[model samples]
Target: MKRLRLPIPFSIKTNMILAFLGVSLISILILNLFTIHYFSEAVKKDFFTISGEAQSRLNYHLDDYFKQIASSTSTLLKSDLNQSWLSGKRVHTSDDIDNIQMELKRYVAFNFPEIIGMFLVNREQRIISMTGNINTDSLSYRNEPWYDLPPNDSLVILPTHRTAYPYPQQNGTPVLSLLIPIYSTDDLNVTGKLVIDITFSKIHDILGKSALGKTGFFFILADDRIVYHPNQDWLGMGVGRTDLASLSFDREEQSSIQYWNGDKMLVSVKRSTITDWNIVSIVPFDEMSSGLKAARGSTFFAFMIVSVAIIAVVPLVSNIFVKPIIRLKQVMQSVARGDFSVRAVDDAGQMEFQQLGHSFNRMVEQINELLETVYELRIQEMHVRLRQKEALIQALQNQINPHLLYNSLDIIKSIAYLENVPRVEKMAKNLADVYRYTAKYAESEVTIGDELTHLSKYLEIIRVRFPHYFESHIYVNEKFHDCLIEKLTLQPLVENAVKYGIEPKGGHGAIMVSAFQDDAVLVIEIADNGPGISEERMRELNERLAFITNHVKDKQLPQESLGIASVQARLVLKYGEDYGVALHSFPGRGTVVSIRIPYRSPKIG
Candidate 1:
């Protein structure tokens, strides 16, 4: 059977089209990134400002509500204490209070549609009369929270509670009970508490009708306890009794201007001018920033349209700009792969492309003059890149040793878990942090603050691992606390000091690690009291220093020795000759490894 081979076609137009598309896509991506970043930041700032403004306006509205209540209550007090009313008090009938209740009811219904119900509880301890469908027979003056309030110098609005008022619908509807003590004319003795029932429906009627958008609730609270909530069952309750408080009122929410509860929610509360009463309003977070949301949506859509337009136009623009260049690249590639037989076609009559056509013709004439030298140089460059790639791989391996150390810490945590120890969680958390820092080598540089955080985690894990064999001490200078170092640099050095320098000592050992900045450089030393290095081995390492630029290229030592060399090599490669490994050891006393590098500030950019 004969095998048929398909034709391998090459086209200059196709290559040019593809390159133009790629460049256009990359340009669009970069523009979108920058535009989207600025757009999102602007949206967030506007949202925050709008939320703050809405909350302030809400607080002002609440103040206005309470002020109206105070004025209306004061009117009732002035009228009820009239000399004619006192003289006619001998009648002492509900009719006498009824006259007062009727007039006040007219004032409230006309001015405050939100006023749910109104009443006058006379000095006789009987509810004199009420307006808006009052069931006087069912009302309990003695047991009600409103009736019990002391007739003090100022009026008070009680927290929310279920009230039986306003006739046929007098079920467990929420209401705020406003109480003002009625006093006699001649003698300024304490009189009966004149109570007014301002229903939740009234608040709903006023705020709900006028609210431009968003669902909101206006209620009162007595400290942490609910006075009157729209959710009637949750009213007159304390914090732990309801899920609303748990979800909505965490420690952080107390101080935050705008808070997130699944969605944004803005809150504002004000203390009443007349009493200890507080009026609070809650509005949907989005409603507070609806204007900003509209702006953001418009901006986002505009950006998207612009992005699509840019994406669509760029390739067309680039095709026009780089048509000649694309043809040049195609001819060059063909020549690069030993297709010297291929030649440019000067089909375009345009002057620039014609010039390019002549240049291509000249290139074909002198191929033999430069081909061999170019090939040799290319091969040499490839060899150098291969060596560099190998070195990079080695460095990566050495840098990742802390990953194994993290696994060991995890094992220790599992043991702690099995033993039902409370400290296990703490140990596990620290172990996780250590691995987090070690794994974040992609960032390459981390702060002294972060290094200390990682070291603290490592030591915590080590403590859990050994339990009895080792105790560690960390000392950091105040001035160098914010310096930056190569990520994961400290953990390996400390690990080596513990494993090699301390463990070999027959009994218990101490590992002391200190970090300080001096002479514009960071000096970190990990010293331990255990088996110190021999003079001969130290001299041998000192001799090989110049040759060993990284931990991976060095000859294999024991696990502990490898950790120290790995840390030193990374420091040198990253920070240059000024930064590297130093060893101090006295045979019986112990060993110490010190690392020095110029103190770079913590990365903020």
Candidate 2:
């Protein structure tokens, strides 16, 4: 048996660096393989997409061009001027020709730059031609072989061809014609024809402007005749006589690849419904492979660049990954040697290193903190013993003040009683009761009966202050008297009603306190009979209450609604968003402020 082992195992930094380099190489290799394998096909797909878009554009332009000419011809066909003048058996006068020529030039040929001439020829060989301007002449066009066209009343589509009378500018250039028959009104016999001659230069611009590749171009064919070609010599050439003979128009294929002129070609076809013409787009197949040729040297260059990058990054990987661990190890060794003052680098290098450093520092700090915590227990116990003694002395000291205050109130009442001054005695007793109830911290909640009784004593005190014009009432249901509500919730509302609703009118005011049980809620209302609040002030008061109630955070209450807001805030804290206060008031009417709380009866023992 034999065993093989390295003298030293590789560290994580070395392993990580090697893994990173390996993955990088493999990814680059896979990418290069895929790129090499699919680059040519991707290029072909993009080329096909571009070619398809070009064909669609050409179809759009051609369709628009044909439609315009068709529409103009249709307009001329129905023209009363065209019918009357062309139907004449005699020659048209120059004035008649100028008038009709101007009409055709202005209405039909104005927008179309590609229209070469609009010719109206009668059966007597009288011609009215409108090109750049109007021309009136006669021609012996009947003897020409091409004159016998538009045999019936139907629209006749003439393929690109030459006219019998060849003007110098258009002598060599072929033009397409749309021949429409003119009829006489009496017998409806065809008396003349309207012919429109159009050049193919516009079609060339529409198709050639967005042509896909250098050698790619478009041509048009109508009824087995070449309607147009980039090479003008091929105009009106038959499909049987050209390189396009192989592109069969009868086939169901809209696009196909074929060999033409010793080169592979991609041909796409769109047949115009308006002109009955087929728009043919031809692009060289060899153009797609040109990028593939460029990419032949790319694969090797990419590999070399990636290999150099891997070599260059090895040291950086060691510094980022390995240096932190080594530094942390040294600090740990120092801590083991009782040097606790040494702390790891907490804000250096990579995120992982930073985390490691922070963890190391926390470990050292926690050790010292645990020691400090262990040492502080004895001192803390001494403080606890001292605090207990002081609390007992403070508790003994706290009971005397309330008792002395009650005794002083009793003495004052007794003196008032001895003097036979009833108001002073009543004021002393009522003031003591109010103070005792407020300072009483025994419970956070109290019954409605207790709260209303407290309110009555406070109202009596207010009555003493303003005995003449101020009044108060309490009308809580006996059945709802036992329901629990948050303590001190109603007092603030009453205070606000008195301050805002009653006090504002200068003393002829009354305060109404009422309560009832509605559904699951116990409601208490404090109303005042004074000059009531305006609608706007009432709305603002209610909205502030609602905002504070829902938000449940301490906010500055508006000075106008302070009392109502304070009560609502207490209710929201004691209960939740469900129970709060709302205001109901109107201008010149008394105001009513309603307080709602959950209907919780007295707890059963």
Candidate 3:
């Protein structure tokens, strides 16, 4: 391994002390920094987890509460006595009414303190009240507030609304209803509707008890509206101003940290399948700040103690470990300044130092020997040149086989690819045409029209490969067709566009190949609407292209980027450093790979 030659800023002893101090302090600082960072992130994750659990718990409880109401609605609909009365199958009787009220009171109303009552409305507008005396003498059942019901055949939970009758509701609280169609026992025909009303106060109470983090609260949300909030006044209000509703959250990312009204909040939500409502939790970020502050303070205190100890021990450490190294350096410096005769003689009585001194002295002796063998090296140089010439001849003889092998492989690959898809003869013909264009090595450059023809052949195969999913359009004017460009330049860039934009995603997208002249430079661009390269990937690609363009002999190409890399490299090498390819891209948006080269006037006839 080669040692980095950092310039000396002070005496060797003083540098050792400083280096030890810097390394020790930096290590401690890094450790503490990692500790603080882990602590802060762990705190954040912990809070979100707590909030998520709270939201999930709220969903469970709300589902259970709504399920209970649904169960009762089913029971009432299936009841023999009530069905007969509501369906008008039996004559009116006082005993039947008493039995119906008793059953509802015994089995349903007593269990849920929040339920005000449930009413049965038959086809004839007859009403059966569970709460007790209903003043239905002059009231039309359809005109009542609780009459806002869903489809008679479908079970639906309605949002909370105010009403007068269903009088003496639990403390003037507003009511939400669960509607289940009353089907008769015999024919499974719709008889009437069962409306089960419950108070919003109970939902608020339930939300209050299942608290989340220090400053977090759980509530019920439905389509961006608050069904029930812990604060009773905010019930049935739109929560549009809150971050919980404002951000277009990814389905995969359930928790988000965002700000609303100048306060940062952690919001998490879980949807209740039973109620079809979102159970949301929002916690102020201030709760975690104090805990993080305390943690950072503790880490800083520990770091300070470690730093003080390092300040004291660094000089003592330098004295013991750096003396022998300083002595060896003095000898090496003399050699570096052209005094090759100097050598390390003293070893400080240490075995490691003794071995090091021996190696240094041997290196000096080898340097002296190298100076004396210049005459012999000249004879070897002639032999080396003769071998290089023979190797070049052998290399030229071997180059043709690879081109032949590549041509054979291309035919086999095209046959294999065509056998799996619908288009066989057409794709085979196009693939052959593409390979034919690539086979010629006599002319390194070709006219723009010929390059587009090659690109068209490749794109047709791609269009066939991903039928109805991939498309291509060439918008370059015919005037620029005769402009000269490096062969195979446009095809590789188009392939890159297809690879990035459509192939990985298996989605419908397009590749647009366009060209225009900008003064002396001709710019050809391959643009794709497929998911694009990220910033880091784009930067790395441009850097690789630039590196290959600048250094032509460096053929160590990465497998994934062989096409675009070769295109940029060939362009820059054929022209000059002023010509190469560049990528402009945004992740999940698209990418445009542009090739810029000097415009040579239309090829002479």
lDDT of each: 0.64, 0.72, 0.71
**lDDT, ranked from best to worst:** 2, 3, 1
**lDDT (Cα, tens digit) per residue for candidate 2, span 514-565:** 8877898878888898777887776787787778776644333333322566
* TM-score (C-alpha, index-matched) for candidate 2: 0.39
> Higher lDDT: candidate 1 or 2?
2
Give the TM-score ranking, best first.
3, 2, 1
For model 1, the superposed segments whose C-alpha errors exceed 4 Å read: 1-143, 146-150, 163-173, 182-192, 201-204, 214-605
lDDT of 1 by residue, 208-229 (tens): 4434245766565677777656
How many collisions between residues are there in candidate 3?
Answer: 1
User: How does residue 152 of candidate 3 score in lDDT?
Assistant: 75
TM-score of each: 0.36, 0.39, 0.41
Number of the top-ranking candidate, with lDDT as the measure: 2
Where does model 2 exceed 4 Å of error? Answer: 1-432, 439-444, 461-471, 503-509, 516-522, 534-584, 596-605
Reference-based TM-score, model 3: 0.41
Error of 3 at 283 (Å): 3.9
Clashing pairs in 2: none
